[model samples]
Target: MSADLWKPSAEIKTLQQRAAILRTIREFFCDRDVMEVETPSLSAASVTDVHLASFNTTFVGPGHAGGLPLYLQTSPEFAMKRLLAAGSGAIFQLCKAFRNEEAGKHHNPEFTMLEWYRPGFNEFTLMDEVDELMQLILAVQPAERLTYQQAFQQALGIDPLTASLESLQQLAIQQGFADIAEYETHRDTLLQLLFCMKVEPKIGQNKPCFVYHFPASQAALASICEHDQRVAGRFELYYQNMELANGFNELTNAKEQAKRFNEDNAHRKANNLKEVPMDTRLIAALEHGLGQCAGVALGIDRLVMLATRKETIKEVIAFDVGRA
Candidate 1:
């Protein structure tokens, strides 16, 4: 081991600034009357989202002669929604979330997340609140809003929602992306690849941009738009080409939620990934009436990185995954 193995990844000064930013965030939520809460970092089930990989461990205690498996939460979303169902109005949490096999300039295996829920709020209203918070923290001006279709049109001259699969494949080939022929049957995968590679780097260059009305197929937990059946009420906030947060006009239909979970598992199986146990309690909570609400999850370390003008995640965190 190196002699500096015991040292923290970030400087003491940067850590101090990080503390102040966290305090400011808490104060901001408190002033808005949003109650701060905590939830477990470990759970019996993990999120079925194929994009996220979770860390798991064995628990050999309590009611079992054999070991029981537990997974570290990728986000505090499920438990928080359960609290919302139990009449916890307008709550927020600053907690650690873990994801396996993730480490890069902007990622770590474990990171702080700021997630919140607002009762009786839609996706647009939630975007306004997120904009206000970003202005307060990063000292940015008012954000620019665009629909997902508009973003794609502006950046790539293609309408993602209406484009044919063959057209998208042609675009991908023209863009010189390798190995895209394998994903011809996956329309969403093609759209996502083009968006991440081309559109994401172009938007939010001047100010925060809120991209809303995602495709119905990509809506994980958001309700489909009543006027536009092709899209859902999901939005993402991006700043300086970095994705800052994702929010949704919460979906409260239990049957629909269960169906989505199973679909996710099926997608996982098709992709040769492990099938995750779905959160039955969350489904039960939805069945018990969660009512109208909007929720968002933001990455705190990334926010701090933007605020502090740091290039890497390690500069803002005291101990990143490698150091830990």
Candidate 2:
């Protein structure tokens, strides 16, 4: 590629606006007494989510010992949670994260993530805090809160939790996403397609929206709702129909967490993908006890996009994958 291709346009003032917004985020957190923390970007284990591919590399040890395999973290979640288990108080981190096989207008192999955790908080409490944080960051009034089911009902006239896989696929086809039929056997995949194609574009139409109470099957790391076994204590934030963050009332049960991780690996095996090692250390931390807490991971790039009203992530990022 030409060197000129890597340079950003001089008129990209949105980049400067993004930087200012990020500074405001840190200021907000610091004022709230949340300590900024740093964690390793490379780890012995990566997230088990089959859909998120992780980039792997090797590290040399002292005395020229054999290289040890390491994976770039998809998020700072595991290590941060370990710190929480070790009794760290309200903390936040802003860092670059990596994910393999992602490149697009809204995606890059390397991207920024802003993650935070609050002790003694549930999903609802954290949702309120996120709403307030958005107001502060965007310098706007309070945002709206809508449950996941309500968002789906408003957009597609169907319930996400109770809808069958076939019904979701049909809805996708009817809505002009004919490719969704290929994932008929995977309910989660079909639901995601429906949401992305039909539902997301309608969310947060007037302001930021907090969509909570996700289906239990799609809870990547959240705890299942005790009152409703079919749903999980998870939520996602959206603005102008763009997803910005995902939060959860963390599941502190080690056994259940292990089960979920193993199931993810099993799915990987079934799909002939390489099996990733489980983070036994994280499970141990959970067993040792993590205080009642809620955590969230927000896409900094998406936030920058919204703050600048940029159409593509490349416009806001310093350098995207195609240039790098």
- lDDT by residue (1-324, candidate 2, tens digit) is 586985873236877788788899999899989989999999999999988999999989795378888999999999999999998899999999999999887888899999999999999998888888787776655778888888899988999888887787788788887764745578888888787777888878788888889999889699999899988999998888678899999999999999999999998898889999998889999999998899999998888777677888888888777777
Per-residue alpha-carbon lDDT of candidate 1 for residues 10-112, written as tens digits (9 for 90 to 100): 9899899899999999999999999999999999999999889999999897896598899999999999999999999999999999999899998999999
lDDT of 1: 0.93
lDDT of each: 0.93, 0.87
Model 2 accuracy (lDDT, Cα)? 0.87
Task: Return the TM-score for each candidate structure.
Answer: 0.98, 0.94
